[model samples]
Target: MSSDLGRAMPIERPDPLALLEQQEAQRLPWLLPLRHSRMAENPFAFFRGAAVVMASDLARQPHSGLMVQLCGDAHLLNFGFYGSPERQLLFDINDFDETHPGPFEWDLQRLAASMVLAARSLGLSEKQQSRVARRTVCAYGKAMAEFAAMSLMLMWSAQLPMKDLIDQRPSANLRSYLAKVTAAAQSHDSRQAVRKLCEPDASGTLRFRHQPPLIWRLDQLDEIWLGGLDWHTWMQESYQTYLADMSPNMQHLLSEFVCTDTAIKVVGVGSVGTHCPILLFRGKHPDDMLVLQGKGAELSVLAQYVDLPVPEHQGQRVVQGQRLLQRASDIFLGWYTNPKGQHLYVRQFHDWKASVDVGKIDADGLRDYGILCGWTLAHAHARSGDRRAIAAHIDEPEVFARGVLEQALELAELAEQDHALLLRGIASGRISST
Candidate 1:
């Protein structure tokens, strides 16, 4: 059956280098070296940056054929804590750049494989790594079963609070670690972002500080890069289009602020080459400031594999997918296309956003974190997909869990080989080492 729980995994082997090269062809040429350098760090790092490769591979694999809005890159690193509209700290999937409606298993598989690679990076024993991987899969099955019986409103309003997560810690050390992460997340508000990225210029105006290669003001770049256009005018036009997309309340909230400065900021391993502009705005009061990011959005890699409809506007696709998967989304979330036809989604640069430091977690902590991530993924899927069908498919929980774990292990092995291939490509000069 297409929705069978224990379908055999596919054995087709695609060329990882080919897929990666294809993806690189679309990214900024200057940033490809940085992307390559970052992915070269380790298997886990490679896994995080190689979503397109996995998407290509998963397309050939057997699936339940149950479709859901996927967090296309659901690796552990992408799940994080952020402040909800109500100022509550909620743990959920944070990145939706590759999001699209596709096979439910694609998300689980990516997440499971990530667990395996992450455990390996942490120097966990094979047995311990297998345990962590299995725990993540089992947790998903258990959580989906619970969600299957939930009322619509109950499911909609449900959130995993930070305190509840901390209380579930397997040991005192893990609990202490979570406490520190939560504290850090709580402190990562707009003020901290401003302090880290902004300073008063000689004219006494708060402006973004210049950081070359990673961040810089548009004025600092040559005319050739700017295409002889006025930076301020171009930025203002983009800002107005973004403002027009916002709701009246959001617009009114933003109306109190005026654009102070804008800069080209490089962000994330996968998103490094994209057009990410940080816009700083100041409100009526001297200290009142807001930072917004205009991030370029491209079509999801899943679109090539699935028979999904091509999104008319890539930015809107990201915004819609984010709203579907996240329990609460950024209030300032919106989309606009510039005159150059570049699709971009706008949101607060940082509003109490934080992520777990995977390296700091011990074996016990990894297992607990894996379970939390599984639960979070299940919740997101349950909200957007048919939970009953998923629950029924995972009817025999242990059996389904075992199946997922086995497949994850298989895929992780493949990913390791792919990582090796990348290293060889770099050594052979087929790929850049920079």
Candidate 2:
């Protein structure tokens, strides 16, 4: 009874500001202001950036103990569309920075809370928000039950056909919205990225556009930031190490292109202060180009709570987690160590990758999208966890949905209070806001 979803809130939790500042200490100092500014935009944005806060809070409460490879930060916005290795467009969990094996319900609870926050941001009524959140858990229970009845291999190989699901939507407006998203996602590739992010230098060499604190070339940084190491040598060594882990065919395919540029690229709400760099490569043909992104990997937020063996290389842990949970992962997914001995994972950049805008959906659209996300999460959990046990645990879908909805509503209130705390911290000079 103590593990009842409705009763899962911790009686006492750490000061959110303290936890935030402690987490920020590990990030790039200069980018802390940007992170604060982004989180201050809205409560949902704060929720997006505060996975550590959630992890800590969730650990203080009782859990179902049904472990799976969590998306780590399974917020609604984290689900998206990306091209598979065979060029098929697919939909599933897109972020795994906090990924580690943990309670299946932790992910479900996060997804539900995100649904409520996102619905509120979209101006949905309280009833509508509750409907969306409850629908997500209901769908998850149903999907897990279905997977529980399937053969192991069948469940493992199952993929969500997002296009077909969209087409099946009863509302024409929702279909139109999803169609636009799919169309936009298809065009979100390297060529589109090149148009937006690249410009020719004086020597007619294509390179990443120099955009100050957000995007910059290595040479653009001051010597103090460079710290006397040669980035050119570092890039060469890091790139080679990344390639060594790739399959022979991929390595051979990549060898056709030469690295032309690499730049410091900042992205995402929670990931703002981490090391993210984008690379440009060009082949013999003038039009042939590729872009790859590298993101620094830290130990999962769940790492502190779970007693699992720590991974020797954080990047490898991320790479392995993505490969396991995603129906089809990026073909070039790999990892390497930087000159500073930090671990980073690499994947193709903007290769038909895009997320639905949570702010733009109506009540019906939100409910539909939540169901899809729930089903997708269930599919992922079934592959790496015991589907039958999970299905049996959440046996009464309606009752379980109500309890999870209550938990989400409570968490949303906590998030709002935490968001206010952040605002007060910024005003008081305890937290940075630039």
Q: Pick the candidate with the highest lDDT.
A: 2
Alpha carbon lDDT at 63, candidate 2? 71
Stretches of model 2 off by over 4 angstroms after superposition: 1-11, 223-227
Candidate 2 lDDT over residue span 41-68, tens digit each = 9999999999999888777766787888
**Per-prediction count of colliding residue pairs?**
0, 0
Clash pairs of candidate 2? none
Clashes of 2: 0
Worst 10-residue lDDT window, candidate 2: 1-10
Q: What is the lDDT of residue 332 in candidate 2?
A: 88
